[model samples]
Target: MRTQEGDKTVELFLSDEGDEVVIEVADQGCGVPEALREKIFEQGVSTRTDEPGEHGIGLYLIASYVGRCGGVITLEDNDPCGTLFSLFLPKVKKNDDRTINPIDR
Candidate 1:
């Protein structure tokens, strides 16, 4: 619950009924425009130009990693201002009810 004009805030929520884990990150900087939202996650796409050699691969990597882990990531506008990123990851379930042993063990 951070409140700053150019700060980023992250919050995590777990559902009781299922294995759904919700992660939300919100930033209060110069908000992303509607037109570039779709392409923001594409490879080699960056909005920061002040820093030299800054490759905009953050969102791209996030999306890719989440997808590889059988999760989903979405970006949207935060209420009032800034951008909000959401990630949903499903937890793995164990089949055996009687024994809960570590896989390595």
Candidate 2:
């Protein structure tokens, strides 16, 4: 996964096996503590200071969207120091004429 400070680094990996796609995002900023990992995904939960226009909904949104898409999202510690977010998405199948053939009647 990519690593950055202000911005998030996203890495997409496609598995040759089953329909599984893994996306990893790593940040070089302050890493997440194991204690708050579960709570971080809750709505309005934030490590940042409360500001006039700051509402903590980042991880909440990420978890929600990923769940709706039939995927799983998890948070882990990045080596040295940082936060790593991983998302797993199931592959979708498409049916086309080229993928099927008509049998003789």
Clashing pairs in 2: none
lDDT of 1 at 45: 79
lDDT of 1: 0.70
Candidate models: Cα lDDT each: 0.70, 0.70
- On residues 49-92, what C-alpha lDDT tens digit does candidate 1 reach at each position? 56689687778878777776678888888777667788887666
Return the lDDT, model 2, position 30. Answer: 71
lDDT of 2 at 60: 84
Score candidate 2 by TM-score against the native. Answer: 0.69
